[model samples]
Target: MTCRIWGRISSINVRKVVFTAQLLDLTFERVDAGAAFGIVRTPQYQQRNPNSLVPLLEDGDFTLWESNVIVRYLCARHPERGLYPPELQARFDAERWMDWQQTTLNPAGREAFIQLIRTPAEQRNAQALAASVAATQPLLAMLDARLASRRFMAGDTLTMADIPIACEMHRWWGLPLEHAQHPNLRRWYDSIRSLPAASGALDVPLS
Candidate 1:
């Protein structure tokens, strides 16, 4: 089935689904729909996704939203890649990291991204940016510690868990902040970022 993703690449959420789809080697069409692109507020788009969010996935007759869920769904379609992790424990372990990426890591870094990248320098909030950096650095260290023992989040092989976190790293690393060096996390990110499928998904300049 042909898949279509509605979102601009500039969006972290959209990048997550796009990266996952590309990593799975799925043929899909991407339509710009969020931010300056518009269309997300349209009646037709809202009918499919009430929240008017980007990265809405349309696979054949099935429509799914929420970036992480779309990633899991795409990975589920390609079991041979082993990105979805079949074992019970491994799957749940991957799920945990994916949830953490969205809940903890993304939120921690969001304010900084907005203030530094999205907001004008004259209008930026220094306190919010500092708070965001403060909250996110420990998480980066935690990830470094987690990766010190494994090549990937759930294990040695890349799984669904790595997709979102890698995208998060892509965003965090792209920022102009003076980030503490996360050797292990950097190692893991470099390896995945080098994958051929990551071309458009991970390499895009942050906006």
Candidate 2:
């Protein structure tokens, strides 16, 4: 089945799906649809994804949205590839980190990213930036502790959990903030950075 992803290449959320597709060796087409491209708001695009968000995935007759959900679908459908573990407990453990990324880390990272990259220098809010950094530190520390014990977030094997968290980690580290030392996290990130998909998709500079 041919896969098409609608989103700009630079979006971290889009990057996660793109990386997952690449990891699975799935051939896909990507169309620029968000931000500067302005295609996401079109009527036809709205029909496919009413939210008009980037990273909408179309697999022949099947359509999916939300980057994390798309990744899960891709992994579950291709179980032998081992992207998503079959074990219920292990899968849930991996999923917990993915949820944490959405519920906790992304909000904090988005604040810092907007202030540092999107907002103009003259209008940037130092107070907001500081708050974002403070909110993100504890999460990074938690990841650090996890990485200290395991080679990957959920365990030694790389899983769906790594994709979203890695995307956010790239953005977090890209910002010009004084971050806490997380040696294990740094090491795990560096290891993933060497992977072909990560080197191509997750290594983009913060926008």
Candidate 3:
């Protein structure tokens, strides 16, 4: 059976999985399933992913959720691509960055995204958006510093670490707010954004 992914393209998490799948040249089908699409709350989707989240993956009889974990699983299946990173320390370093993207960076920027993109202008929360921008800016600076010395998140080559972070950056950059230019981060992001494989995922307009 062809691999199937459930999620809308507008979601950063879903984009990560889609970008990873594209990078690996994997044959898969992506279904629109969240937000206005409204399929996630269905009983069938809930059975496959109790969280009822976007970006659920089903390959044959196996099912998986959590975007980053799905990325890891897909990359692991295609070890020759080396996106999973074989070296012990390198693999862990990738894991740490991926975790940081989810736990730290995403939370900090989420409110800004919500207020600016999702919420109507009249209903937007200025204080919350300000706080979210403040929290996320420092993290972006840290990522800039991290990428200054390396071509990619884990090292010279694109790995699982780069997928989620790149998707996050794509979302951040798409926002209408003024942003301080982080040259190295921009450089890295541009390289990834320019990839043929990243066309659909990274190039999509922000909702």
Best by TM-score: 1
Clashing pairs in 2: none
Q: What is model 1's C-alpha RMSD?
A: 0.7
Cα shift from native, residue 146, model 3 (Å): 0.6
Write the residue-wise lDDT of candidate 3 on 1-207 in tens digits. 589999999889999999999999999999999999999999999999989889999999999999999999999999998899999999999999999999999999999999999999999889999999999999999999999999999999999999999999999999999999999999999999999989999999999
Error of 1 at 80 (Å): 1.2
Question: After superposing candidate 3, which stretches have Cα over 4 Å from the reference?
Answer: none
RMSD of each: 0.7, 1.0, 0.8
- Cα lDDT of candidate 1 equals 0.93
Tens-digit lDDT track for model 1 on 1-207?
779999999998999998888888888999999889989999999999999998899999889999999999889889998899899999999999999999999999999999988999999999999999999999999999999999999999999999999999999999998878889999999999999989998999999
Point out where model 1 deviates above 4 Å.
Answer: none
| TM-score, structure 3 vs. true | 0.98
lDDT of 2 by residue, 23-111 (tens): 88888999988999998888998989999998999999888999899999998988877989889999999999888899989997788
Residue range with the least summed lDDT across 10 consecutive positions in model 2: 197-206
**Would you list the rank order by lDDT, best first?**
3, 1, 2
Better of 1 and 2 by TM-score: 1
The C-alpha stretches of model 2 lying farther than 4 A from their native spots are none
Ranking of predictions according to TM-score: 1, 3, 2
Clashing pairs in 3: none
Q: What TM-score would every model get versus the actual structure?
A: 0.98, 0.97, 0.98
Candidate 1 global TM-score: 0.98
User: Which has the better TM-score: candidate 2, or candidate 3?
Assistant: 3
